[model samples]
Target: MIQDRYSLAFRLYPYARSADQDATDPVRHPVVIMGGGPVGVALALDLGLQGIPVVVLDDHEGIGQGSRAICFSKRTLEICDRYGAAGPMLDKGIAWTLGKVFHDDRKVFEFNLLPEDGHRFPAFINLQQPWFEKFLIDRVRQAQAEGAPIALRGRNRVDAVAPRDDHVLLDITTPEGPYRIAADWLIGCDGASSPLRGMLGLGFVGEVFKDSFLIADIRMKADFPTERWFWFEPWFKSGASTLLHRQPDDIWRVDFQIGWDVDRAEELKEDNIRRRLDAMLGDGVGYDIVWSSIYTFQCRRMERFRHGRVLFAGDAAHQVSPFGARGANSGLQDVDNLGWKLGMVIRGRAPEALLDSYHEERAHGADENILHSTRATDFITPKTPISHVFRNAVLDLAERHAFARPLVNSGRLSVPCSYDGLSLTGVDGLGGPDRTRPGSPCPDAPLGDGFLLPRLGGDFVILAIDAEAPETMTQDGVTARRLAVSAAQDPSGALAARYLGAAPGAVYLIRPDQHVVARWAQYDETALRAALRRACAKE
Candidate 1:
């Protein structure tokens, strides 16, 4: 176990006797989260802020030791920003925009993820997974202090789960004893090895590559730039491929693509790992190994994320190779897509049918991630000699030819998946910028005081850009207020460029998740009402 190598680094929520544990009858909750990882805690925070009660059950108290996931995409940072937790993350994370791909000792090609300006966040940030979870928990604490209805129970392991027609029952084992609880809605954010998923007799179906990678997080004072550097058949001759990334606290993550046939026990030896490091860093370059582990990833997901009243998010629903940083980023996107829809349903503002869209939309996302991950894995580890020759040819061309640069895939870093043509999407009559089309996440732009996204907030909003709209409108028991901003508010003209291309003005109906559901050149009350209904699945 990885935990055995490290002490209890964080005991944020030690076990304590809960009133529910003593209840004669099983206590009931509106929503119960199975795991307290980043996705679980973020969901709790999202729901808690919306006045929804959520209880998170975890076997352990706080973050475990390891620089588990270090790369976070900009879309994830934007989502975290909406939860008010991105501040701490951005403050502590090492932001990077450049990525360099090398073939052997020579650089094949380099690319910049975020070339344009006016956005609030960079392309990516490198921060240890533990710090990311801690920042989220800290926000949860602050929210709790402000009377948010969120509960975190540590050392509470859910041993069994019973699915009912309307709700799910959970049998929890705590340090004190055992207790039973029922949840109106149960969320499985457990992980890849999801116990809740197994307890329900569910399984993931997809492909698992036969290659392995060794990740060594070392504490060193090296003068390496904060960029993603990937090497194919590195000159150091340590492994087939190598990846380097910088994190906070002078910690650097080094990934070596060791072959599958190697002996795990032999490779994990301290002397063997040190020999590889010595070859890469040159002799006498001292460093301390913070954490090291070998991981083999799979591109798989459940056929359905929702089963009756129980829904799976994060690794419980889907998993992918860590190549693109899609594992955690896509999981958070699942929470973002589900949080608002679930909130509305629990509050009786939307029908239960709305929950089905969570499976539909997020399943689509999971499939997309799996496809990309599989391709990247195949490219990084060619299964046959012909494929290897083709990959090498593309790499050689990328060094000198501009068109072949696109063919080089050193893991297509995570990008937000557009939900175009999906069920919840509405009409895009405005014909404005394609980036802000229906079912697409609203892109960040610079406004007068701050950025454009923070102003949208977390709710169904009518974003009126250089257009007239009502102050607030209620449709089907759900209210959507208008945020009127003019092109003049942004001196950079990014607002007009992103939301309104050559059009005179535009009006957009944004979902609680900040995804565009409908848009028009002029505000029409009747159309807006119908769009709101469709967005809530009332149509």
Candidate 2:
């Protein structure tokens, strides 16, 4: 019999005789996430908050070294806050307000993300990925300390994943032994060359840039502003591109272009790499190289995010060039999109069909991001003769035309993606479309006593204007509140138009993920109830 009560064997077979007996048994969890990267960890944390049990497995001993993605947008920070992970991240991260784009030595364009918003948080934060991972790990540990049935298995590699009609099974091997885990759902966040995606016969189809870039993390002694990210085109004597960002520990991340013609093995030498860094920083400045690697840029996305009971997320589902910093940010959004829907289905609140929207919505967003990042890469480092000429022309035009600056910067950064044509987001009316129409993210508004946006709990929100005598509508287990509104009292014109159209009273139901599920101009209890039922049931 198992002596330890909390051992895997004991958990799998409480009355098991030995390891051999437990091997014949199956370990089950509501959700099983493969890969312990940020996306996988975020999903686990989010689900754990929802009182769901999750098992996360990864092959690495701990968070990997080097700075991969160091930028976090306000939207992502909001999601992290929902799980109570934002405070520590904010304290440890560097909040950046400015970013500049340059060509040769001349500044072409610049943007300041800070604006007049009631939000207490900054618009963007930059932190080393290793430290960021540690922050998340700490959060996960704290939640587990509070009795969440979440488990993390490091140094464990997933050998195979098999999806059946009812459940998905994962075969994972550790130093101890091979184990079988049966889960209601399997999320593959295993990076670009995902074995799970391959096992499911899913193919990622898109373009791969022939050029390669070198990334280096080094400690610098120069007097450079630590608050902004700098990009250089036709950089250094070799005329390759370069990028620089500040990290928390006085360390800086630099990306230098290594032409495809360079020998990968010989070019990565410590001396050669140090020489390039010295040249970039000038001879007087002393620095120590922390890490370095060569990576090829690709813009590919999985044809389908969902394959039976197995779903792909993060880099496993799609990949974009590093130019726009969309790769990690997009993956975080993928988990955000799927986390709640998975909870709804697993908890029997919504039908399985609701999960289909994951592929439909995220694939579109992934394609759009890929296009954006690809354009940014081409603009920064023109590979072809035609592109080289066009890049120079655009740079010259941007110098004279203020309108051209925004266009050039559009593809170089992150923007909130929308699901305009999604079946779940509802129809766009024929009238003047409100900027915050159905299917778009709910805009932030100030409440009498504090900010209203951050106060929205993780569940779907029903914003009814009337404080007293607000009518309640329930459908298919989904509920909504109807409020009486006056045109004169409407603070946000967009919200008023979205819910009430031209009417004075209206009802709007928002999803847990912040997309509008349904809206009505006039509140009719019966009709509103039916809409709620259909949306909640998601037939």
Candidate 3:
């Protein structure tokens, strides 16, 4: 019998228990993060990379149960790569970009998520959430070994939050006892149903689906490819949807859209699970159910992520249905956006108002995710009979008609959210691909034996494409280096095709978080510096 144990827990991180502290006074930290999950750990590593001290408190001692959040997006992989976790993750992940949609007996259109190849990583990969967390934790520990200022305190739960003018105080309950601490700035990556959110009495508003889905990770010697296969009313199961994915260690992740009013306990039984597997994989196909779970879909977000000196990220700030793999991916982007800006605020480089961009940017991301997931859920499990008939018609049309294929949404795969017209978006100096424009993630291209994303990460950079390299450009604690590019720099001309198009002598100003802020037809030092200031919220 596979015992359900949180036994994957890592060793305890030593921390002092301070039960006695004046209500007005507490030991202060630069950044106090509540939640040591992927989002919290990513924030800690990002702050540590900037030499900023951060304290992470989580009630759990180790990684969470089951193979949760299985699909990792390209943007997420890029962020993980920046934090030094991608190498291990890539080694243990099953990379794929192809997905086929099956409508009962007929096969609908298949998709190649990333048809082109200049980027360093694939469109998506499947890895257990626990393994991904362990990789990020290992990176955090490595940074700690190298004297990075990060303290991860496991089994430390924040019980109270007292937001102040300049700092936020936290009352924590530990395994040993209760204690209090303060932070110059507080961030809650605590996840869905966050204690910190409840303590602050924030509103999480969104839609909830009526149907429940079952996730079962099975170990079997079947011929399932790494590619994703989503079905609608396949004969092997009930008249519902099913998703198949391959993960590490020969494990297959199967999600069955078990309708509402199901006997969850009975369905989760080993006999029932094995019976379902037998029906799907045939009686002769040997398999073992490793993990099984049933969960209702929800699409919700807080009214605001920033509340005084305390902020929220990840599921604490917002949540989406698990359809698009946006929950964890968007949360990682939240850390990517907040980490640099928060570090700047701590270093006195940018005004505290810069943190507002974190809320603006990530809330935008959350909205996009929620919108996509809600649409997917509605299509997957139509509340009305008319909606279900329409969905079936779309599927039937998708089988033969190319135009109808665009209407099909087997979870409209996760993608980066663009901040095109936000307050920080500078001038779009030239035209480019839809994804390579201002306020978008930089389009990756091959750079001298490596890719462009690694080089673009960690700092604000100005790329001098087909232009003279600028001598120097610096703004409020932000320095921009000129990286000259030529036809020789990109032999495949992908960089030019994506960034410059037909325009020559173009330059782009990229933010520290790797989002394109502005571009210029020519590298004007004055305009470049101004854009840098605007990007950092110092203008």
Candidate 4:
């Protein structure tokens, strides 16, 4: 029998207790990831890439149900590329750049995601969450075949979690029996309603939006442009706002704000779904509903992501309203932020203090994502009578005036959060342009007909632009790879202009995760090494 492409099940091997040892026998690993979701699997791959041994435990045998997270951002694509899954994703996912907003019946404004010319990935890709997870699982399997030292154990549910000062203990229940395992570091990627988070006694804090949303994914044969279209109080839906997005396989992901008092069971009935679809998409439109779900989200996060040797990443640590596609994107960023630091600490290449920066930076990222999503949620569904009036006024004014257009916020969309003035490197380094600031993601540009980010992440790099490569950079026991960019590598001069506007020579100290640590107008080895140490959290 052939496996369903949408729902692929992998065989689950039993983790039976040893004949001599009972369930009390403690099997230990360096890093044990608690969820086999995208964040956990990505972290496993990232650690495996760094030659760190890991064990990933998942209760489910395969990917989750439905298209959970559909929008994949450019930064997210880059991160996936590093983990060897972006190529398949870009090919299979629907790549879109343009978006149109509507108020009532008039198409208010057309906006672009500001996609550039040189980067390999587009601004965004609309793919089902299941497909994305499948891709990640494929990469994980490939890594396992290549001896990455990663154990992906399916159907192994974590029953209990005990955090120690030095190690974390996990009680895993499988088909054969229940056994206990210990880990040097435990990452909770278990997602919202996370069991590990509850067991750890981490307090979740934030506001829950009063409005509920219904997401409907349907397969339709329509010649609609592959773009995001959102409406505020559309004539068809009267007082509600609706969002329309295109996914792969001629699938359309539609969302409508149904308010808080919805009888979800009644609302999700076939007749109700058909009525809503007919109102917006025409009654005779050739379509088949794939799936639909009602959701009410909260922009909340844990008080702390780090609890001794245990850490939280992805939806387990923070959850934002799904409007901005910040949930999984930010989760992957948390993986990116923590993966390298954890790997280094495990390898004894960096001090345990290095993990502090991960907490600081990811907490900052989670907070930033929460802030943007909260603002979007508020604008989409204002609570106060006065607030709704002002919102209506802004939407009405946006149709006529240019200045009011900027005030409209269907969703701010996920953007890279600048880690300026943080404990890791203090502030954004003195840079050529604001784009190349410290704590910002390394910009991807045409480099020798390829891209810049491909060669940057997974290691420390000293990018010397239009200047001689810095002298053998051996900084604080670790050596940095020196990249020399010339007119040839940066054929169109876009990279040079972005990194070295008018400056004669420039050096950017990039971290293992491809974040700019420091940039100097000139290459001074001493200053560069000191900056590297600061980035590594070595005072």
Best by TM-score: 1
Candidate 2 clashing pairs, residues 3+ apart or interchain: 475-533, 476-533
**Position 359, candidate 3: lDDT:** 85
RMSD of each: 1.5, 5.4, 2.7, 3.1
lDDT of each: 0.91, 0.71, 0.85, 0.84
lDDT of 1 by residue, 1-539 (tens): 11222345577988888999989999999999999999999999999999999999988877787788889999899999989999999999999999999988899988999999999999899999999999999999999999999999988899999999888999998868899999999999999999999999997877878988999999999998888999999999878999999999999999999998889989999899999888888988889998999999888999889898999999999999998999999989998999999999999999998999999899998888888888888899999999999999999898999999988877988888878998899999999999999989999999988898988889999999989999999987999999999999999989999999999899999998889999999999999999999999998
What tens digits encode model 3's per-residue C-alpha lDDT throughout 419-534? 98987889887765667788998867987788888987778888877887575677766678877776468798787788877786578888877899988778787888889889
Residue 8 Cα positional deviation in candidate 4, in Å, after optimal superposition: 7.2
Question: CA lDDT of 461 in candidate 3?
Answer: 85
Residue-pair clash count for candidate 4: 1
Q: How good is model 4 by TM-score?
A: 0.95
TM-score, per-candidate, Cα-based: 0.98, 0.88, 0.96, 0.95
User: Which sections of candidate 2 miss by over 4 Å?
Assistant: 1-23, 227-235, 409-411, 427-434, 466-472, 480-507, 520-527, 530-534, 537-539
The per-residue C-alpha lDDT of model 2 at residue 424 equals 73
| Colliding pairs, model 3 | none
**Quality of model 4 by C-alpha lDDT:** 0.84
**Ten-residue segment with the worst summed lDDT in candidate 3?**
1-10
Task: Give the lDDT of residue 529 in candidate 3.
Answer: 80
Q: Give the number of the best model, judged by lDDT.
A: 1
